[model samples]
Target: MPRVSPAHMEARRRQILEGAARCFARDGFHATSMQDILRETGLSAGAVYRYFPGKDAMIVDLAHHVLREVAAVFRDASLAERPPLPDVILGDSLTRAADLLTFPPSLIVQVWAETVRSPELATVLRTGLNNLVGHWRVLVEAYQRNGWMRPDVPAEHVARTLAACAQGYLLQSALVDRQDVSVVVEGLRGIMSIDAPTTQGT
Candidate 1:
């Protein structure tokens, strides 16, 4: 038996995950079956099973991928060379939010809905959220040190508030498309004292 290269293995795994995401997006996770994923990927049942044991496993991986992509956006924004203004950060946040907002809200909605029923999925989400919050807390503190943000508000409070705001935006956008998110960003700037409202990007 010949060995598969690491790159090939990773590519194959991503292919399965992508197909699963599309299926879940089209149909709620509960409604999506392994066969549906197989059909989406154009892979045989055996091939699909080789990568993911079942639908539950596929959902878990898909959810993690989504969370990680979101988390990376925050982490990158935090680490950028030029410090980002609050409005700029907010805009960037929305842009990232929009990326996850893709067609068929059911993808995210399904995973969110599943947390109540699946302890395993719940843990994955919780851990990913905690890590994201931690990153934001650090960023908030950095902003405070440089007087870019208000010092009166606690860093943890600010981070958690921003996170909550993002989730709220996601929910609203998922329900009704084309919402004017600038107002929300302006409100956040006021709360955080993110100066230079004109600042566009990092």
Candidate 2:
């Protein structure tokens, strides 16, 4: 047999990762095994190891993949707006996440659970989520400079607050028996708005 090129190895790695994500998402990480991935991707044990040395590597990649996907969704929500306010940007984001769940729930939820058992997965989750919040802070500051957010509140504070709320909504939507996205949006709008009649101040 001929040796495989680096590009071929990378492609195979991606194929294995994609298949592993399906398995991990459906069965949870601990329950999944190399044999499961082999069945999912139709590759032999040696073939799988050629791309990923072990199962932890695949899960680390899966955690990264999930974070990248959430970041992309919020990034698209920002780009699609004509002149995006921080509120609209966030609202669009939660709405996008809500829609994504309707089709197939994200692997992020599974990844979060698996992190409890895997230190590498936990580290990936911590680092990736920090980076995501950082990107959001940058976007919030830009919107503040454009007068899209209130001038009094610090952009970083607003960014974290909104991210916390949105993350909570992700978990809540999974549990609750409702489709009240407006509930989240309205609550967030109240948190930021100064003209709310009752507590209108800096």
Which candidate has the top score in lDDT? 1
Which residue runs does candidate 1 get wrong by more than 4 Å? 80-82, 93-103, 178-202
Cα lDDT tens digits, model 2, 121-200, are: 89888887687677677778777777766678787787787778877876675555444778877887787676656475
TM-score of each predicted structure versus truth: 0.81, 0.71
* Shift of residue 93 alpha carbon in model 2, Å: 5.5
Q: Against the true structure, candidate 2 has what lDDT?
A: 0.72
Q: What is the Å distance of residue 186 in model 1 from its true position?
A: 5.5
- Pairs of residues at least 3 apart in sequence or in different chains that clash in candidate 1: none
Give the poorly placed runs of model 2, Cα more than 4 Å off.
1-7, 72-83, 87-106, 176-194, 198-202
Judging by TM-score against the true structure, name the best candidate.
1
Provide the overall lDDT of each model, using Cα atoms, as 2-decimal numbers.
Answer: 0.78, 0.72
Residue 179 lDDT (model 2): 45
Could you give candidate 1's per-residue lDDT for residues 127-197 as a string of tens digits? Answer: 99898788788788888898766698899998887788877776776677756678678777786553546
TM-score of 2: 0.71
**Number of colliding residue pairs in each model:** 0, 0
